[model samples]
Target chain A: MADRPVSDIELKAPKGDWRDAHVELRKGTFSNASLPKDLIALGLPNPRKWQPTDLDWQLPPDWKGILLRGMRERLAKYRSFRLFMDVCVRCGACADKCHFYLGSGDPKNMPFARAELIRSVYRRYFTLSGRLFRSLADARDLTEDVVKEWFYYFYQCTECRRCSVYCPFGIDTAEITIIVRELLSLIGVSTHWVTEPAANCYRVGNHLGIAPHAFKDALDFARDELRELTGLDIEIPISRKGAEILFVMPSADYFATPHYYTLLGYMMLFHEIGLDFTVSAYASEGGNFGLFHSNDLMKRLNAKIYEEAKRLGVRWILGGECGHMWRVLHQYMDTMNGPADFLEVPVSPLTGTRFANAASTKMVHICEFTADLLYHEKIKLDPSRNDEYVVTYHDSCNPSRAMGLLEEPRYVLKRACNHFHEMPAKTIREYTFCCGSGAGLGNDENMEMRLRGGFPRAQAVRHVREAHGVNLLACICAIDKATLPTLMDYWVPGVQVAGVHELLGNALVMKGAKERTTNLRGEPLAKETANA
Target chain B: MATPATVEERWLAAAATVSGGLIAAHTLTERDPFRNPIGHVLRRNLAALVREFFGAMDEAAIDAAFGEIMALRSIQDLSVERAVGFVFRLRGIVREEAPQMQPAEAEARIDRLAISAFTQYLACRERLADLKLNEQLRALGVARRRTAHRGGAPA
Candidate 1:
C-alpha cells in the first residue's frame, strides 16, 4: 500500500504537435478528449495509480457546508461580476491581447468573448425578462450540452488572469472560471493533474509522492549540492516547529529538477539574513494544483497549509513564486484561507519596505525579497561575476499580471548580473506574454496546442537572443522552470530559463558561506540556465 | 389598465447582473453583441448556466444558489414591468387588439400566465438538457414543440 504511488506512475510528454493543437481544438477532436470519462473521474483521470489511498478526509462534515456557502455567496456577491457585466463596450480593444487568439487567429479566443460565455448565463439567470418572458434581454438555463462545451473551453482558459489586467474595470473572468471548475467538481469530474496532486498532498503531504525519509534525503541532496557549489557547510534548516518563518514551496521542487536548487538558494538567503525558517514535512506541498481541480479541492488542499502553519506556531509564512500558487495566493487566498495573524506582512529586514500588498499575505516573492535585500545593501557584492552571458527575463503570467510583480525581478536581474537585455515590451514586464504552457496546458495531453501557443513568446525570446545575444532567461515561477526549458530549446535556441533568485545566488555575498555556483543548485551544476 | 415596464428596463434589469456598461453600450447600438454578437451568444450562455448549475450546485449547492437568489431581498420587491412598446408594436391585428383589450381582468390573467409559462419554459428547456433522456423529461413532451439539442460535445 505504501509503494502504491511509486508503482502507479506514467509521465508521457503531451502528445501531438502544438501548432496543430489549435486546429484540432477548433474541431473539438485534437486532444482526443473524452467528456464521458472526464465526467466520471473525480479530478484524477487515471484512477489506478492516481486514486488517493488516504481515506483521511478528516473534514468536520459541517465545515464543507460552511466553505461551500462562504465561497458561493462571496462569488455571487463579488463586485467584479458587476464590473464585468458593465464594462466591455465590445469595441474589441481586447481582441489582440490574448495569446491564443494571436496564435490561432481565432476571434473566439478573445477575453471578452469568453467573459460573455459567463455573462450570458448571468443575464439569463438573473433578469425578469429572461425569467418572465422570451425577452432576448435576460436569463438562460443550464442544459447538459452546455456543460460539455464549458468543460472543453474552461480547461482551455489557462486561467491566466491576463484579461483582468487589461479590463478597464478590473473584471476578473478567472474567478468565473474558478467558480465553474468548482461547479464541475461537484459533478464528480476532474482532470488528472488537478486531482492527482491534490490527492497526493492530502495523502502523503507532498505532491511528488515522497515520504518523510525521501523528503529528508532531498534536503541532504540540496545540502551536498550547496557544499560543492558554495564550498560551505549549509544544512537546509529542515522541519523545525516554532520557527519564525514556515517557507512553503511547490513539491515539484523537492521531487524534480531545478526546484531542489531553488530551495538551496532560499536556504543560503535565509542563512545570510540570520532568519529562523523551517521546512514542514506535514504540509510540504505548496498547493498550486489545488486551483487546477475543483475549488472544493482547492480549498480542501489550501486548508492544510494554514493547519500546518498554526500547528508549527510560525510568525511568518513565505511562499515560493509558483504560477498557480501565486494565482491562488494573490486572487483567492485571502477570501478563502486567511486572517493570518501571526505573520505581519513580509517586510524585508534590510529595506523596511513591505514585501507585497497586504491583500496577498505579507509573503514576498523570492525575487522581491532578494531585490529588497540587495537594494538595502544587506548582501555583499560581486555583480559582474555573472557577466559571461547576456540575459533576458520572461515575466511569468501570475507574478506580472496577477500580482504586478514586474520591476522587482528585473531589479534583481539588473543588480545581480552584469549583462542584461530586455525583450520587446510585448514580451517582457507587465505586457509580457504567457509561456505557451501556462495553466496545465503544458501537460502532454495538450502539449500539441501548448507548443503552438508557445510560439509567439518563443519568437520574442528568439529575437532577444539574435538581436541582443541573450543566453539566460530568468523567470520567478516554478511552472515556468518546468516549461521554459522546452520553449527555449525548441524556439529560442541557445538560451536557458532560471529563477530570478537563482541568478542572485551566483553573486550573493554570504556572511558565513562562500559564494555558490552561478546558478541556484536546483539541479546538478552542469545544468546551466541556458537551453540544453 | 396596468402599465408594463419599458423594454429598456426589462433588458437592463437582468443585463445588470453580468455587466451594466456593456449592456448599456449594447442598448445604444442596434447591433450589439448581447442581442447578436459575432459568435452564438445563446449557446454560450446556456453552456455557462449549465456549467454553473452543476459545477457549483449539488443538492446542497443548489440550495445555496437558491438561498443566494432568495437573499436578494430587492428582487422580490421589483414590480413586473410590462414591455408597453412591445405590446404596442405587436404585428397586425394583435397590435390593435392588445391595446383594445386594455385593463380587462381576463387579459391580465392571460398575460400573467404567459409570463409564468415563459419563465417556466426556459427552466424546463434547461433541465431537459441536463437530464437528456426523454423518459427523464416525462413532463416536457416532444409534442410540446421542444428543440432537441445536439448535446454540444463533438457529434
Candidate 2:
C-alpha cells in the first residue's frame, strides 16, 4: 500500500498526434474525493470512503434520479442558470479566453465544452427537443461516465468568469460550472481539497480547523513577532464586545507564510490609526470554501461573520486581503445572510469617509480603507522602505472581477512601494488570469493542472521579471499568497509572492515607533543593506 | 565545424518535428512569451542545450536545460519514448551538420544526454506523485499540531 502512488489515478498523456487524438481524459487531474467524516459533518450525502479512480463510486442508488431532479430544481430556481442554459450560441467567442484551455490545449477545458458537459445533460433531461431526439440535439443521458466527465471538467474551471467577459451573450460559464458542482454534490461527489476545508471551516470556525485557543496563540505569536521587529506593543483584540469595528481575514493570514506578514501589517496599521476593532475567534475566517462547494455551505460559513458582528456589537465589518471572500461578501452575502440592520454603514473612524458602496453589505475592504487613508494623507508612509522590491500587483480574480476592485489595491501599492509595475494590460484588472489554483483546486495532487492553469499568469509574471526586474509579486488574496509562491518558484524563480498589505506594513511610518531594520518578513529592509 | 547559427537551425528543425501536430502553429509563431510559453520555453531551452553541447559541454548547464524541457513534457500527454526521443533527434542533426567532428564521441555524448533526459523525466513524474501525499501530510501535520495545542487527540 505504501509503495503504491498515493492516488491510483494515472495521467494519460495524449497519444500520437495530440491534435488528431484530442487530449485524453486524465484520471487523476480531478481532485480527491471528500472524506467520509467531512462529508458527514457537512451533512453531504453518501459519507463513505472513495476515490475518483475507484471503479465503483458507491453512489446513491437513485443518483441519476437525484441529478435530474436536482437539474430540474436548479433550472426553476435560478433565472441566470436557465438563461445561461438557453443562451449560449456556441459562436466560440470564449473558446480561447480560458487559461486552462490555452495552457492544457485540451479542447474540453474550453468554457463552452465544459458547460456543454452539463448543458448536454440538462437538455436531455429537461428540454423538449433534447427529450425526444437526444443525439440529434447534442443531448446525452446522465450515465455514470457522463457524471464522471462532469466531475472532471467542471472542477477544472476556477469560476474566474473570464469566459463571460468575451461572450457576446454574456453567458456566465462559471455559473454553469457552479450549478454542475451543486448537482454533483447531490450524489455525494466532491473534492477533499474543497470539502475538507469547508468541513473544517464549519466545525472549528476556520478552514485549518484552528480552535479558539490555537487561533489566539497564532495571534499572540504574531504580536510577539511584531514586537521583535518594531519596539511597539501592538494590541490584537479577539472577541472583545462593543468594539467599533469587527476585523475579519482569511484564516491563512494567521497560519500561512507571507500571509502572516500581511496579518502583522494589519496589526500595525490598526494600531497606528487607533481604530477600535475586535477579531472574533468564532468568525476567525473570511474565506468561505463553501463558495466552492455549494450555496448552502457558502451561506452556512458566511453566516458566522454577520452573526459574530452582531454579537460583538461592531459598527461594520472590515475584511482583509482575500479573493473569493470578497466575492461572497460583495455578490452573495447581502442576499444570502444580510440586512445587517444592527451594524451602521462603515465610516472610517480616522478618515471620516463613509463607504457608501458598502451601505447595504456594511463591510469595507481593507484596500479601500487603506487607499482612503492614503488619499486623505491621514497615515504617514515611507515608500523607500520597500525600495528593495521591484513590485508588481496580481489582481486576484474575485476581487477584480466579482467586486470590480481594480484600483484600490494598486493605489495602495503605488503609495506603499517605491517602484510598481503592472503585468500586460490584457492580464491585469478585470481580465486578470486566475492563480490557477482557485475554486479549491490548489490540492497537491492537482499540481500539474495547477501549473498548466497557472502558465499564463506565470508567463505574464516572467515577462515583468525580465522586463522590469520585478521580484515581488504582491496580491490581495490568501490563495494567491499561498499558491503564487509555488507557481513563481516553478515557472519563474527569484520572484517572491506577498500581500499588498505586507508591503504597506513595511512602509508604514508609525508614530513613536523605533527605526525599522527589517520588513515585516523580518528580512532586512534595503537590498544593498541586506547584501552587505 | 557547424557554426552557432547552423546548430540553432538544426535544433529548431528537430524540436518542430518532435512537437508533431501537438502544438498549434499560432502558438509557435506567437512572439509574446506570455502568450506562447510552451513555444518560448522550448526555443530557449533547446537552443541552450545545443549551445552547451557544442561549446563548454557543461554538464550542469545541459542538466538545467533538460530539466526545463522535461518539466513541460512530463506533464504533457507525450509518452516516455516521444518525450525523450527529441534528444536522440539532435544526434541525427549533429551528425548531419558536423560529420567530421569525431562522430563516435558525439554519438556517445548524445546517448548520455538522452539518459539524463530520461532521469529528469522520471524525477518529474515522481514529483507529481509525491505532491499529493506531501500536501495531504502537510495539511494533516498542521491540523494535528493545532489539535495538540488545544489538548485534543490527533486529528
Candidate 3:
C-alpha cells in the first residue's frame, strides 16, 4: 500500500463555493481505476488503465457517435428507456427519497439531477426541441465533461429503483442509469469494482473467481463447521445429475463471512426437509455484476444458470438469498435468455406448494420456499433459540423494489426468531434504502461513498437498536450479507448482520441433531431462562 | 440566568450557521433522523458538546461529541478549515449564554475543544484512508487466494 498521510489524499472537492453544494461532487465518490487485465480479458472496448479523475479519458475519437448510437438503439428497443427519457418533468419528489442525496447532501446525487446528466445529452441528440432551442430547452451538447459526469453519477446509483416508487410519471431512473452505464461501457468507461467482477463471473462462473475445487472446499469447510455445531452430516450435492432442484446463490454465500453462516442455514434446512437439490459449480454465482455493466454482458453471464440446469437435468431451480440476482432472474432473465421450457415449474417437495409466481421463470426464492415450509408446518422451528437476538429486517433494494419480495422474508423471519422489530415504515419494504454498496459499488475504494449512501439505512438500524435493543439485522440479499456488516460496524457498533436463512438455521430443530449450544457463528446461544 | 437547554439551543444555532451551507435548508431542518442523518448527527453532537462544556467538563464526552461531528465532516467534501471551524463558532455563543462564567476559563475550554476537533477530523480522515487501503488489500487477497486455488500465478 502507498504510505500517504490522510491529509495528503486527493479529494475531488466540489467546484465553486458552498452555495454550489447541490452540484458538488465529492472526492473518493467517483469510479475506481479499472484493471487493464480484467478489461482486456473481458474483451471490453478500449481496454486500458484509466481513472475517473483523469482529464482525458482517452475516449474513442468518435465517442459521441458511439454514445448517441447506443442511446438511439436502446431508445428504439426499450419503451421504458424512451418513456423514462421523455417523461421526467424535473419534479423533486425523488430528491429527498434517495439515500445518497440524504447522506451526502449533494443535490446532484438526487435522482432527477443524476438522470439530467444523461437526459441533457439525450435531448441534444434525439429530440427536436433540444436540437432547436438547445440551452433554453435544458439540453447541452454531448462533451467529455458530460461523459465524465455520467461515469461519476451513474456508478453512484445502486440502480435500486427506490426513486421509481416515488416518481409521479413512473419514470424508472434506475433504467436511465443502466442505459447510461451501458453507453459509457461502449467507450471503455467502467469501474474495476464492476469490470473485474463481470470478468470473473464470465470466466470463473463467480464474482470471487473461485475455481470449482475452491468452491467445493468452501462448502466442505461449512459442512465441517455445521457438523461440529449440529452433529448432522449434511449432504451438499454439487452438480449431481437428475436432481429435483438446482440450487444457486451469490458466490459470497460460500466464500465470505456472515454469508457463510447463511450457507450452513440452507444446508440444514434442505436436509431437514429431505429436499433433493444440487448446487452447480458452473452456476455457482446467482448475483450478476453484469447487470451493473451492460445488458449484453448481463445476458451472456446469466445464460450459465439455465445451461447448468440443463446439463444437470434438474427439474427446477431454487435460488439463494441475493438482491440483484433476483432482480435479474425475476425481471430480465426470461426475456434475455429464457424460454426455460426445459425446467419444470418449481414445486416445494416438502409443502406441495407450486410457485406460480415463478412458473415462467421456474425459479423459487429460498425465502419464498422457506416461508411456504413454515406456513405448512413442514419444518419444526425453535424460535427461542433466536431469543438472544432482537432482530430487525433490512429490505435489500432489488428484492424489495425490483422483485416485490416484500413479505416472504419477513414471514420467514417472524417464524424463525422470537424478537423481531421493523425499521420505521418509510425505510422498509418498497421504500427501502440501498445498502449503498450494491450494483458493483461494494469495492473498498468506494468506502466513503458507501458509508454516505448507507447512512439512511444505518440510521434506521440505529433507531431500532436504541428502541428495542436490536443487535442483529436480518436480510435476504447476499450483498446485504456482505455490505451491511460494514455499515453496521461503522454506524451501529454493537449490531450484527445476518441472512434470514442464517437466523432460521439457528431456530431449526433437526431430528437426532446434537443439543445445540451455539448459533451458526459458533457464538454460544443465550441460555434458557427459568420463568417458573 | 439561561437554563442548560437555552444555552444548548444557542450553541446549536451557532454550529448550524457554520455547517448550514453543507446541506440544504430543508434537510438541515428535517426532524426525521433517517431522512437527514447529517443534520441529525450535527444537532445531536453539537448538543452533546454544549452539555459537556457547561456541565462537568468530562473530557471524554467532549472528545466523543467532537469526534462524531468530525467523522462526518471529514468524509464530506469540506476543506479542513470549514470542517473543524464550527468548534470555534461556539465561543461567541458561550460568552452570550453564560456572562457569569470566567472569560479566561471559557476561552481556554473553547480553545481546547477546537484543537480536539481538529485532531478528531484528522483521525477520521486517516480511518478513511485505511479503509480504502484495507479494502484493496482484501480484494487482492481474495484474488490471490482464488488464483492459488486454480494453480495459476497470483492475480
Candidate 4:
C-alpha cells in the first residue's frame, strides 16, 4: 500500500540522444571529471540547488494509494505493458541493427542495452524480491533525474520491433519501449515528435499536419492519377454509402512526393477491377507512431478509425504498407478495437481464402491484397512493360516480420517484372531488415538521422545489386522512398527504389487508356505543378 | 472523403450479407450471387474480395465486404483459434467463384500475400505471434534485472 503519489513533476526539454553522452563516455569524459567539481565547471544545474535540504519530502494525497495503484494496475494489464514485463532475453545480436548504435557507437544504443535502462527500474518496483530486498537489482532511486534519463533515451528508440525477429527467445524491445513511454506520459512528460502528432491526429486525422482543404486536394489528385492512367472515369470516391470497402490509408500517401505514386497504383488497380472503395478523410492516416510510444495514445489514435467506420457504415478496413500502421492493426487493433462481428473475413476475391483473421474485420496489407489478386487470377498483367532493368525487393520491416507480408509482394513482383531478382543476405520473410526510416524517423527534420540509420541496410542492398546487376529496388513501404535512394547514393550509388504499387501500375496496360507518360526506366519524372 | 466507419460495421454488414444471402439462397434453386439476391452475402463478400484483390476497393467497398472481418471478435475473446482456418477457407471460396481471375495473376498475387500474410497479417494469428514475441522479451528483461541484482550473474 504505497501512500502519497508524487504529483506535479516538472517536464524538462528532450535530451535528444544518449548517444552524445555515450560518445563522450567512450572518450572517457564523464567518469574522468564526474568528480563533483566537474558539475560546477560544466555549468550544469547543481543538485545542491534542487534538493530539498530544508525539509523532508512528503507524499501528496492526490498521489496516494488507490489512484496511483489503480494506474499501475491498469498499465500492468495493457497488452504491450504486460507483454513487455513478461518477455525478453538480453541477447545483443540486434546491436548492429540499430541505427542509433551505428550512428553513435554507444553501448546504450544496442537494442538490449537501451531496454536495460527501464527494465532495471521495472524489476525493483514490480518484482517480488526487488521491492523488499534491493540486494541484487540495484533499482536506482526514482528521482527527477531518473525521469530525465527515461525521457531522453526512450524517444531515441523508434520502436521498430526489428530486434525481436533475431532474438533466440524472441524478445520484442518495442513493446517494452511502449510501456515505458506510457509510464513517462503518466508523469505528464511529453516529446515534441510523439505527443505533437498524437495531438494533431486528434484534431486533423493526420501525422503530417495537413489541413482538410489540402487533404481534399490530395485526394482529388490521387483520383486524377486514376483517371489519367486507366483512362476510365474512376472516382477517388469519398464517403459513398453502401460501398463495399473503405481503403483507410496513411495521409502521408495523400501528401508525400514518391509514396504518392503508390496511391496512384491503388487508383489505377481499383479502376481496372471495377472495385467500389472509398477513402475516409476522418481516419485516413495509417501510420501509428503513437502506438510505438504509448498505449493510451495508441487507443486515442485508433478510436478515430472505429468512429469513422461506424459513421460510414462500411465493412472492412484495408491498410497501406506503412510500418507502425500495420503494426497497430496486426498487433494491437483487436485488443483495443473490437466487437467487430459486422465485418466479414477479408476473403481474397481471387482465391476466396480469408485474409488474416477474417472474423474481426480482417485487415489486409495493400501489398498482400495486390499480390493475392494477381495470384488467384483476379488481375491481368503486362510484364513486358517492366523490361527496362532487373528488379530486387526490400522487405519493409513491419510488413516483413510484424505483419508477415514479405512473400505476397515478391510474388506480385515476379509476375509484373521479367527480370525480378531477390536481394541477398537476410532478405525476405522474417530475416528481412527495416527500411532505415520506419516509425517516423523518415521526415526531413530527421534526414541526417535517416541517412545514418539506413547505412547497414544500404550495404545489404548494394551487395545484392552489385552481384546480380540489379538496378531497381521495389519496396512495399513509404519509409523506404525517403531513406533508400539516399542510402543507395551514398553506399550503392546507382541503384534506385520504387513502390510495388508503382511497378504494378507500370505493368498494368489499361485497354482504353491514352499512351503512357511514365518512362520505361520506372523512375517518376518531375512533378506537374498545378498553378498553386 | 466519406464519413468514417468502424471495423465492426464493415464486417457485420459483410457477415450479414454472406450469412443472410447464403441462408436465403440455400433453399432457392439459386442464381449466382452477382445476379440473384444482388445483396447476397456471397456476392457482397465477393465484391469485397475483388476490391481487396485488385487493390482499388475504396472505403465504401471495405464497409460492405471485409468490414465484418475487420470488426470480427478477436480469437482472444473466443476460446478457439478458428479465425485462421475460417479466413483461409473464405479465401478459397472467393477464389472459386470470382470471374476474370487468371492463373498468372494468381501466382503473382499469392507471392505478394505470402510475405505480408506471414509478416503483417491482421488476422489474430500474427497478433498472437507478436504477443508471444513480447512475452519472450519481457521474460528476458526480468531475468537480466534479477541477475544484475545477484551481483551480475554470468551468462
What digit string (tens of lDDT, one per residue) describes model 2 on residues A195-305? 999999889899988999989988887777778778899989999999999999999888867687899999999999999999999999999999888888999999999
Ranking by TM-score: 3, 2, 1, 4
Per-prediction TM-score to the true structure, in the order listed: 0.64, 0.88, 0.91, 0.63
Instruction: Give one digit per residue, the lDDT tens place, for model 3 in A387-481.
Output: 88999999999888888899999999998888999999999999998889988888776788898889889999989998999999999887787
Best by lDDT: 2
Give Cα-based local distance difference scores for all models: 0.55, 0.82, 0.81, 0.55
Model 3 Cα shift for residue A192 (angstroms): 0.6
lDDT digits (tens) for residues A1-532 of candidate 1: 1111112222232234212212112321123222333333334332221221122312233533443454456456766645565566766666556665444334345778766655555555554565665225533444433444455556667777666667676667677677666655554434555555556677778665578887786677667667766777776766788887788887766655444446666777777777778888877887567776656567767777778878888766788757777767777777787767656666655567765575346565666677777778788756655666588888888878877888888888888788898877656666777876655555544543454455557767767887988998887776777767765654455787667666677667776565444555323233243435
* Candidate 3 residue pairs in backbone clash: A12-A27
> Second chain of candidate 4: TM-score?
0.31
Worst 10 residues of 2 chain A by lDDT: A1-10
Q: CA shift at A428, candidate 4, in angstroms? A: 3.9
Worst 10 residues of 3 chain A by lDDT: A1-10
In the order shown, what is each candidate's alpha-carbon RMSD?
Answer: 22.0, 6.3, 6.1, 26.2
Off by over 4 Å in 3: A1-27, A528-532, B1-23, B92-102, B129-155
TM-score of chain A of 2: 0.95
Docking class of 4: incorrect
What is residue A166's positional error in candidate 4, in angstroms? 2.8
